[model samples]
Target: MTVHEDVGAFSPDSEWPQDATEWLMLLREEPDDAEIRARFEVWRSASPDHPRDWEEITHTMGVLRRVTPVVEVPVGRQVRRRSVIQRIGLGRGRVGLAAFSLAASVVLLAFLGPDIALRLRADSVTGRQEVRTIVLVDGSQIVLAPQSAIASRFENGRREVRLLKGEALFTVRHDAAHPFTVFARGLTVTDVGTVFDVDAQDAGRVTVAVREGQVSLGGIVSEHSPILLGAGEELSARDGTTETRTVASTEVGTWAQGKLVVHDWSVSAVVARLSPYAPGPIMVYGKTLAAECVTGIYTLTDPQGALRTLADGQNARVVHATPWLTILHR
Candidate 1:
């Protein structure tokens, strides 16, 4: 059995019995085959989970589609006269590369929509020290920072949103039957007549911070706790362990107003929080620089400016590798 099958396959062709990856690749070469086509339909309709997986595949295809439109090359540049030797070798290589690329594209297309929708978007933020608010199409709001992205799809029975990457605070509009749901890793945060924020980061870690109303979080989180969270309450789960803690809701809500406040926070902690706002890496070279205590409230629009302001207070010099990377040394 192939690894995907050995591990339990999602949509493998049982007749051909190809691995999930290979099955996807075959669709490119033989998309018209009735057996493959029927099997594909069966796989998608087999369970509720299949459509979600398919959505991820479609989003990735969108990325490739957008990227493929822009290409620049000088056409018909005669570096050398077309010789028989050059033609034979060049043709073979070109055909091989094309076939390989096509196969890869099909597999990627299978998981593109849902996965990419959950991860990439028109805009995204990561490791931000400040709380940033994003306005959605249906007049809802998303407060994102500290490695977060929010993607929305106005679908029937649900105005759905997939938090593909990072952490985000969601203020959803009230809809009884058509609830707004946020998907993160293995967990799903569904609003139960309320507004909440969910922080889903790398390593299956998730934090649900509620402001107004209550939310129900599902998945095998923890045995000791209930899944419901009310205002001023937060749920944090790392692997199998889960805990709920009460915090100042107003403090977390500060992101909605475009402010992030920090007090006596370690440089590592600050960087961990701040990295989400700036698009690229924010790293400190020395322990002295990395361990410094930071205290302040700053706007999301200007992270580098915030760094400069912080440097001025500490009497330190700020050196930036690029526009996005900053390093402070005394």
Candidate 2:
């Protein structure tokens, strides 16, 4: 009997059965086979929760089999196997197999939904206060800002990037045969051999700023015309409304150089942008103080000093409640 020890890592407290589903699927396909049953017994005893999850899954499958009837499929008839699994009930072993298939699908979906699946699929991620640059297979470069995540794929004459969170600046390599496209926050930005910055923050808020060349921006939610942008162009989109304007091309992606240039941006917005660079949380107590706008180029090398400069300029009070907490009040 051969035992496969190469099964991936498993956490006892994980919400879903990790590698156990593989064992279950194998058993379901060959229930009467003794080898798989023996291997499953070995795997089930490896951890305490493994047996508990297996028993619960078995109970669920039994309940499903009791309620669902199997339909007969004609021999030599064309039918989708996945659809057939839900409709057909053979003998005891086949019924258990079908039940297991249905239960496994539900378990996997509940455990690894869209967000977790994306995080798992991401090719690279940047932590807080960390910036990373990745050179793609096609010679394109992407600089990921703090706390950003991205997945890239180049196949079938197309280059694609899915930005999961935070910001990224793309310096695309011109490939006429394979156009580069970026997906983020229900929006798509297709590169036209240009350098552009994409900021995908919380609540479906996204900002795309062009530093060179041109690109097309469109919403994934509705059928809308693509907004074209050139050098020094900027577009901000939130909820459903989108606004486009002009910015200094040289100052567009200055954060990559350890500087942040803001032109008359509100204090809250400034704090929000700086929070990613700060070691801890920056909270604004008063709405009026947060709404006050300031314009300047701040050095990210000293986040606390930048905060102090903003506070002193606006006559606002900076309270250091804790080493990790900075509060601003008017």
Candidate 3:
């Protein structure tokens, strides 16, 4: 394999990794052949994009492995396009392997299909560094925080919003006949014409903070009683346990204003909140450092800068392993 010195600057239309699917197909067809493996290694090393393309292909394969039962395709039967499609249950539609270029189709179906489904189902979704306000057919409004998704339905004499992921602030449109509700993390938040924020916390936990009017929080299980909250009140529920306390309205859902306000929160917890706004993964190494309490209002506009500030305040060191990976250590 002739290594190109200007491989990184290679044209996107180049033939190197553009033929990645063929390479993958070849590897699948002859996995035990040392000669083919050696040539693949040479081709992969010939350009920077080659490994990236291969990583994407492998990632798609991993997704396919998880969704489907069959793991390994037999070397002899790998080239049998119909068998592969039947195994993955893609034979139902007209989308057979014959309809598309083999490797490209596999990658697209495995990777982009799920995302397209999610986007189609979601009424509103926000990416990192984006705060979006969406108005429903009714007079109700939602302020979706970064990396959040919500599906809204205003049918059958009911107003409902499902928080599929992340946090959202809902300002309900008061209608006596239509009750407004938000379902998140296996909990239900029913509004009494209120402006409130619901956070879908990790480990099936949820936090509901009411800024105005009133709202009720209840678990999906019938045994769990509903907790009614008024203005300046907040409720945190997890694992059949619930905690309620008074909170300042100013502190609820302040991320919409490019600010993150936390009071006596652990470093790990704060990092979890900031992860949605950060460009990539933010990790904390030391248990003690992660456990340490932090209280401050950090700007969300510059997540990396805010992280460095947090590290300085906690007497920790910030390490950038890559442009997308940040680690905080004591």
Candidate 4:
């Protein structure tokens, strides 16, 4: 049941918690309203608890927004377009104090989760469809994929980057004295004067694809001996086991060129990669469709179009639940 439904009674609309919820929901519903925004600022600064209540609600909603529910499209198929906030049923205009307090306690914990720690330490971060390139002090270039983040540590004559989330393509400047290294999900890829892509995906799966030169790969790093992958090589690690494959050098980092290249990868994997470009979550449902493996190149120029094409190929359909969320159903 929704928090709104659980609260059998509500206080007057004057409470700070209720007012804060109403203001935030209204602003989100009509973000272009200047008058509403101006009034909101006044309300926020009215009292210390006003902004305090606002911040608490904002952080709760922030984490809730990312809690994508990839469940089966609701039965009866009465699909409707709604943002995550609306779907979760946070009281829109009349949230009771008790109701909001209940929801906030649960979601606030998630707001302070590991993602917050990553955000604190990250040197670079990219939002949806926002790819960024960072140049280190040593002249190496790091191209961050959409929804990606990284933290670089260059102290003690050691050049290393911790891939905090998503993926990044690194073009290292040759420095024999200090070898460049990338760490993601317990896997390590030490550069051998090369360009390589490290994709850190869900379930502790890390894929490292070398394009230009060579890289030494180690799984869980501390236990396994490091292996080498020269040009046109890729390695995927799952459960501490590694698989080496041959991928076209030109296919690496193709998302920067408006294309995504994969070989014998699952449809779910494709959705995961394309999701960074999509503003909201792109859910893939149905066992058969989710398990379907695909090959060949796909377009990233239009993530929605690419999703539709991928769903079509896998005998699934893309449903536009809202501007923020897309569902692929079989």
Candidate 5:
């Protein structure tokens, strides 16, 4: 039997668990690299504990594979992966280079149930540090931010897209005969021949910002009398409350261009926006530190510098520069 099926055959020594896990992730990332395989053979023979540690990871992955194997992010375009969570803890941990959440997949899967379910329903997904532009059959364009997913349904002469996770900017093509609508959370943004950005990243909030033209927001707020937003206007809906504010239209969806624009956003929120582009996890500790507000345009290409600058402004600091993690504390 294969290594995965014989988990009982090997009693894991746990001596080189971390090393073995890292090696497994690396190998999966470069399975065809003969050099890496050769080096792995050398390391495997270095100690007997190594074999058991490696076997333990195989068992874990095998279990996960059997339980929830593939995630098909396919419709009519190209996708990066079709299995496991791309970033965060597992799938591509150590900041997208290795895996760290496999051992804790069961616990994480519990917490990530909703997101995993969303991924299963998604038609397009952008992994960590990936930004993708999809052109539909109607010539409309969709720019998905990092760690984002969307599912589109174009039937009955109407186009509807659901923002599964993260964020996306839609540039709709004018179709008077057909309507284009985007759904997120409990809000529906119906395009009025316009370009708009929908963000569902903030906790319990789906933000709609119009870059050009107008869009009516229905659902949660009555489809009969949908709220209308013009160019340069933005709306945020959360719980039962809705808030509207005006921002420069040019600044909307700048994250797709490697710049993050935030206004009066909490320090914790700003860091959350930066985490997808970062090489490691960015942790903001303490409620007091998390509550402070920040407003400015930060460079996403240099996430480290941006976080440091943001922290400096709040009299806070970012510690622990581990390649896979960053900690922010007062």
Candidate 6:
């Protein structure tokens, strides 16, 4: 099943070789074909462009196979080969060879279409303290925050995403067979089609917040207690205990826009939130100091300033345990 054989599948009058599918089938069943191997060399030498297109077809097939399970060959609506020997219709008089060449080109293009689409659709990485907004081919929007990395692959079975680090906000487009899933650390967040936020913390914690739809969060998250959260709801996991809490966080996604608003929270909790953005370590001197409650809006633009403000306003002192470490005490 070579590109020459499948001319009709891609374009009815295209002279493209239908050999791509055959090579794919052969590679899957019996990859070490001596004849195919020999033919590959000769084919490459035939024309510099021929080998390039051949590689493109093969690459396209591989991507398609990984993303979609079913591979089909169409018989009736076929692509016809064009005049291969014809140089921009120069060899039109030598019709047969030109037609064969044209057909090969069309079939090759068809096979390569899927691969090109995949490349255009995939989203890769977001570095430290940075943000990336991706518009997927399916029209979904994904905003990945700093230090986050995400990879997406869409196949017949599902649309999968692996989050290597940090956080992401997914505004998914609806596709049941291609359900969107974000994998991070030991957790997996699966969504049909919704807007949600996923955070992968360094301390073996994963948090999922649903802004406009529903999501099933599992793994180191809730574990056996897989929870579904809707708009304005969030779930957090730590040590093995999972907690689901509701907040009046109408602006739950302010961090994506460079603002982090913390409501009534303990000093320890506030310190924990500030740690990631802080230039140095932040520690509360004693258990009582750490447990002290903090209520204010801290600007993330200048985290060190916020620390100084905390010390001055709370009648607390900032102690330098070490150059890289600092603790707060009364």
> Tens digit of lDDT per residue, candidate 1, span 7-89?
34343323332222223333444556565566566666656865654564445435644653422222222321122113223
Off by over 4 Å in 6: 1-128, 219-226, 278-287, 317-330
In every candidate, how many clashes are there? 28, 1, 0, 0, 0, 46
TM-score result, candidate 6:
0.52
Error of 5 at 123 (Å): 0.4
Tens digits of per-residue lDDT for model 3, 222-249: 3467778999998888787778888999
The deviation in Å at residue 95 for candidate 5 is 17
lDDT of 5 by residue, 157-256 (tens): 9799999888999999988788898999989989998989999987798999999999989997566888999999999888889899998999988887
- Could you tell me which 10 consecutive residues in candidate 3 have the lowest summed lDDT? 91-100
| Candidate number that wins on TM-score, 1 or 3 | 3
lDDT of each: 0.57, 0.69, 0.69, 0.69, 0.72, 0.58
TM-score of each: 0.53, 0.62, 0.63, 0.64, 0.65, 0.52
Residues 52-156, model 6: lDDT tens digits? 555755665455345535323332211111222122123211223222222232333323322434334436654333467888777788887654567777766
When sorted by TM-score, best at the front, the candidate numbers are 5, 4, 3, 2, 1, 6
Q: Which candidate tops lDDT?
A: 5
What lDDT does candidate 3 reach at residue 313? Answer: 99
lDDT of each residue in 40-75, candidate 2, tens digit only: 666687778777667654664566446544232233
* Candidate achieving higher lDDT, 5 or 6: 5
lDDT of 5 at 294: 81
Q: In model 1, what is the error at residue 69, expressed in angstroms?
A: 26
| Winner by TM-score between candidate 6 and candidate 1 | 1
Candidate 5: clashing pairs of residues: none
